[model samples]
Target: MKHPSVRGCSAIVLAAVLTFGSGAVAQAASAPATTPATTANPLDFYITPASLPANNGDLVRTEPSVFYVDPLKTIRAQASVQRIMYRSVNSSGVPVAVTGTVMVPYAAWTGSGPRPLVSYAPGTQGQGDQCAPSRAMATGEEYEGIFIAGLLARGYSVAVTDYEGLGTAGSHTYMARESQAHAVLDATRAAQRLGNPQIVPGGPVALAGYSQGGGASAAAVELAPQYAPELNLKGAYAGAVPADLPAVGRNLDGGLYTGFLLYAVTGMGAAGGLDLSPHLNAAGRAKLAATDNECTLQSIASSGFLNTAQLTVSGQKLSSLLELPELKTVIAAQKIGNGRAPQVPVLLSHSVLDDVIPYDQGRQLAKRWCGAGSSVYFDVTAGATHIGGYAAAIPQAFIFLERRFSNRSAVSNCWLYG
Candidate 1:
């Protein structure tokens, strides 16, 4: 339960103020009463069955499924039966979409009212859509992402965003906060519009993500108050979040974690409108471009999972490119959790021994939120590494979320008490 020194934690404080201010504005607005649309029609923001690409390849599922959350309790369910290609455009106007399978459980309790929505943002699994579906209903080992089974089993309607680029076109925004947040929130909007006749509309909504997904979830939390105020977000759960990008970059630099750097560079280039090809001389850009769409496994296999030292761009060292002030500024800005405190309650979890992301970032985030008067539960899982920490924290995270929606106050001082 070690806390970062409180001196000069103004960045977090500013974020908190901004978060509250936005929430206040949204709350003050006279929003229309929540209602189910009279017409049982699909939302235009999402792609319908007919508009989907014919050659969706092997990633499509044609089974009918039910997705809903308990109107009375906190449980949720997503049963899969039909699949469609989800399409959306990025800030750059680049069209990005993914093949998504929707599933809702048969026992969903929508009678109490509209259930809460859990729009999930997934972590890195390379540029393929096969493993990026929100529910991991597709066949394959890598497709078994961390929380899909558990969440669907609990009756939560989970809309997974394949991000802006990976499953659709262009480059995926690995950790671009605004872009990732927009994609995650918009996907939830898409889900509401692409409503199943069996499911109710406009339920309380929540956001969750792990690792890269964690980054996206954090962004969604920060953005939901303003971007999609109608979602009625009750809470957010994020674990092993890459909150501080520069800190992570420094730790991973020239080490085994360099693959993330590669992904970051590509993602940033795509999201920020930076042309890495020009930054590197002609030959350097060519070498980097060659590795663009390859999956993480392919990069590791071909590169021997080597550190940055073993990798080079057009004969230039990786460290040299990273040293540039422009790149440094961008990396510094991509830290995940440093943004505004969310309007609703938030569950933040991290492990001290996390091999990838630094634990200090999570601690700092909690401290900042607490100071800003946010009800945050920061759980530091003992002796858990990245993957292990996520597993250990999920049950508690869900429990905390359940309590929030049930109108029960959580033990908000857990971080300080520990």
Candidate 2:
């Protein structure tokens, strides 16, 4: 038998790529449930309190929850978990309630000065409330559970954000960078404020995520200095970042991941207050309706190989829809590396063969950040799919976090990229 640690890692990588091929959607239909099937009533903890705390990251409510490595609940993480609702701000600057989970490992912190907290932003979970990470964590269905469990085993506390409107109210502001960044930073704030002895206030911190999460963590690094300046941020590990939304949209237009393109359109429209009725034809609306309720696996499985030209009223592809003046502005707002460098070092990784997100844009983000004098280690992985790209970066990301938390100087390979 393989070691538990090795077995765990293998399971994680396998689950991450569960929907691997072009025909994976058909496989997903027969796959087990990723989201909760049904419920008599919605969990009240997710309900936003009528009155919110004045400050962002202030804890609103919390309840004890369980964290399982698998949906069978046989293998559980050796940690204490809590389902928390915290105050956060949206892109429009409104105070809103956000849901997330905080995990503190059972192991004692022996290596570091204090136990560091990793504010982990998850990749796309979907646009529905049922698909929230907090819910997934409780059910052992979180695709990122393996990575989150890895942090716990290392004696680091992990704070995983569900992002704005993901589990609370309204539509998920997916790919809206500002709101996503705010949620990630504030989740760290809320975790520290939980008053857990293991995770103290003002403790050293870092960010970790990939894909949508990569973009969120990258955005958090850029916004932390000004928005959450008081945070003791050390570094970030961002993998397969969708740094350029337009480029990502183009890549996902008619490919196996067209569902993601639809998600971006719906999510950004919600965040930007755009009425998409005029832009979407009947087919587009129907597709959005299905995509809205799905989790990551289901979304990819059902909407694979769908062409945007078939969905639009004007018979234009999603690439063309992205060119509209209204969408162009909002989509551009989601772009990362806008000349402002993160105050801390970042480990940015991407695969040369990523099928979901284009690789050049990830490289371009590194160049932009490096140009701004940020200490960035661009770890390039070869011949990996989008999920595989992150899997390959996991070891490097962990090493990067280890160095940053140890107060060691981070090495930059910017010259190599140049």
Candidate 3:
């Protein structure tokens, strides 16, 4: 099952990726292509009426749908789009229902080989079912739909997951890493299993996400080596990764992210067994329920900069909620840097001045993963805020994906390889 090792990318600091290995040859052949895999039919891959899988990563079912992706910049009509429900495991390894969408652009593969696919994970929208990417993308109203349009313009197929429960009939697991990673990776598996010729059944694939999505992408890359090894993941681009849940929690507990804390605590509680009713006072309980249908604006505006200590019965910080044994175990599994090293290359970007997820945690992620022998392309953006860092990282992020999809090996700045 081993493929030949391609040449590695140049370890440049803040420069666009240089031509490497057979990339130049591949590019010289056509618009852009890579090592192709075998062709397939829809049923040849997916199991219909997909019975409950005993395994962790599985594709449940898919139904065709329209994607109203009219971004600020318009592109050709979508060739195909589907609303898919798949099977994935939570942080505790229990099977859960996950939802997402797969879209193919009007652009066709003009290259010598098949087209590349990018499995994109959107950052926090909200805990509400209305905030799901598939729901928003349907109306061309999703904030990130414009960005997705850009990917379609690049002539690559795209698959986006709404994570488990966000768009479905349950509470979102929020920051639970395993659930997030399973949803993202399974979206790719579901797309390929659909046997879309535009997807290049065996072509190179990449992962991209920012913030919560970034953390999910990091988890996907680490888990990809085992959970879904059927994929040929070439690279992952993660922006503002929340590598340390403990650190992130301590920072957000008494700040503008009070609603997010509620979401995470309640989310993990729902997934695991941490009940907040014992810890939260009556007002806190009411606020949490009132925000059930609230989107980002509503959640942030209502709970911003508030301290959880005032809402709790003991009047202490929300961090105390993590004192429970099962909760601590789930949160530890959600931490990103402690997992298996990514077999593929990874691009990690973070703003040095991020207010939400600390910049130091991102640095720690790179250092620890590099120490574990991961090829990391670390970019520390200057002056930008948490969201701004995503914009700053996009240009080079594409370069990273292009080089990887073109069949090049990735070089690392992680030289402390002892």
Q: Global lDDT of each model?
A: 0.58, 0.83, 0.72
Q: What tens digits encode model 3's per-residue C-alpha lDDT throughout 1-418?
A: 0111111111231122122112322222222222213226422222223356555435566666555433321322344677677777777776776778887765566644678889999887777776777766655556555456556656678899988777666778888888889889988887887777777666778999988899899999999988888788889999899888878888887777767777788777877856668778987788777666666656777888877787779988876777667788877777787857788889998889888889998888898889887889888787356656666777777778778877777867776322
lDDT by residue (218-259, candidate 2, tens digit) is: 999999999999999999999999999888998998888888
Q: Pick out the ten consecutive residues of candidate 1 with the lowest summed lDDT.
A: 1-10
lDDT of 1 by residue, 290-323 (tens): 4555555454444434445434544555645555
Q: Which stretches of candidate 1 lie over 4 Å from their true place?
A: 1-78, 81-101, 110-112, 128-131, 134-136, 142-146, 278-287, 300-305, 313-320, 337-339, 414-418
Q: Every model's Cα RMSD, please?
A: 13.1, 7.4, 10.0
RMSD, candidate 1, Å: 13.1
Candidate 3 residue 297 Cα shift, in angstroms, is 2.2
TM-score per prediction, in order, is 0.73, 0.91, 0.83
- Model 3 poorest 10 in a row by lDDT: 1-10
The runs of at least 3 residues in candidate 3 whose Cα sits more than 4 Å from the true structure, single-residue gaps closed, are: 1-59, 69-79, 323-326, 416-418
Best by lDDT: 2
Positional deviation of residue 353's Cα in model 1 after best superposition, in angstroms: 0.8
